[model samples]
Target: MALKNVIGIDHAVVMVKDLDKAAENYKRLGFTVSPRGTHSAHMGSGNYTIMFDPDYMELLGVLQPTEHNAPARAYLEKNGEGIERIAFTAVDSAEGAEEIRARGYPPVGPTDFERPVTMPDGTVSAAKFRTFQWPTAEAPGGVRIFACQHKTRETVWIPELMKHANGAKRLKQVLMVAPAPATEAAHLAKMIDRETRNEADGAVVVPSGGDRADFVFLTKDQLGKRYPGVSLAGLPERGGAGLVIVADVVAAEKALGAAGVKSAGGVVVPPADGNGTMLAFVKG
Candidate 1:
């Protein structure tokens, strides 16, 4: 059978110099992050995950300079605390890799990897994943893209871990700024095996078929107009300039107030207050 198209982004990966500080910043923004997870010595990295059902956010950093830590360290140095990767979801990762190969964008894996995830009962279980990864070097704009198949979903998406104080329900869209929206978005769509359509005033919008999310691509000039306060510190490499999410406006307002965040007016956290990642919360 032909593999399924991109089901939507599985997760947005953020690289940080300090996982503790990163988690603390997210907490200040009213998010509930998971416990620290250590990668195998071969991988040489540690992470904190924010679970949102099947979709989650990953904050990764180097544990030490091992084989795996090199990549994370390099990304942190190059990007300086911003989005480093975007993973698309597929029912079968190997199949997803095959589809990418067919799409003219050759992929590296559907490689099997697992980390011991602590269960709600405090028992340890393997959180297995079949991942097809595309390194930033392969992408036109140096943004990492991949397909992920979750083999043990239950072990990762425990119900208790899904709740957040920010009242964030789900990720709605990702705001991206590229030099040329149409050209860059077309390339990305092909990688994801999704369709790209033009939006008003020289922008491209790619709607993920796998889930309720969209990728909005715009020029830096247009992005500035739409979100005045957002800083364009890191452009295409940062990848995720802004993240849109469904959230309770009232709760967001309270949280922003308590955090002394003046940028978020009920539902928006501009880059200034959002760890260089602009955040827009859809009032619901």
Candidate 2:
């Protein structure tokens, strides 16, 4: 079977302990909120707000749990609240899920959804999506890709809160840091059959479409030295807790400085150790 056509980034999920506080932080940075909704009712324990931009960002936090339904709670217990998944848009949702499953990756179904979004034209547009999940217990790069097809292409809504004034054209790359870079990179490479390069910082970049996703392995020793106070002892070995969003380097740096957001040589870094937020604008 042919590989699924990756359209682009569908959305990036950030897991937080308190959705309200997280939303406030993001709002301070400038992100317009989308409508609120629950995930696959079957998943049983979470709610989210979809923030629109040229690309989407999802703020996911667990809600009160029902007896016997505790995955979200378990996740919070383990990861201590951070980014859980990064979704990509595939060309054919069903085929894509199947292709991944056929290759030995745990692939979830093509779950469908119809949601209403307010368009820039002052009209409401209903959008549909077919989502799939890739289950990787020990690899860290991107977790899943959800492909979507809208009823009316004429009314597309990209959230204004996500747009940066620095001319950050698009999501150029995603950086994932883990513990076993080589092993995780190998598994990801085998799964996607893509070329990956080992970097000096024990990181690997797997090229996909026009964008590249980088996975970096951080050992306990490394974490201890770099982040003295943080604890990530028994967290899930896969998935990204942090993300590095890319933009146009020069313009982004200038824009960030003008906005009073501090930067480290043009790169914005968050304060967490194993998990955090970062943004960079390079040549692309």
**Candidate 2 lDDT (Cα, 0 to 1):** 0.52
Q: Write the per-residue lDDT of candidate 1 for residues 1-284, one digit (tens) a residue.
A: 22475577788777777889888888888888887888776777788888875578888888778864565577667767766667778777777777778766677776777788888788888788788776446653445777778888887787888888778877777777777778878877766667788877777888766555788888778877765554555554325677777877677767766443333343577665666577777664
Weakest ten-residue segment in model 1 by summed lDDT: 258-267
**Candidate 2 backbone collisions, by pair:** 52-159, 53-159, 178-216, 178-218, 249-281
Where is model 2 more than 4 Å wrong at Cα? 7-9, 35-54, 64-70, 120-124, 136-156, 159-162, 165-169, 212-241, 248-264, 271-276, 280-283
Per-residue lDDT tens digits for candidate 2, residues 9-50, read 556666667767766655444334554445444444443443
| Collision count of model 2 | 5
Clashes of 1: 1
| Residue runs of model 1 more than 4 Å from their true location after superposition | 1-5, 230-238, 258-266
Best-fitting candidate, scored by lDDT: 1
Count of steric clashes across candidates, in order = 1, 5
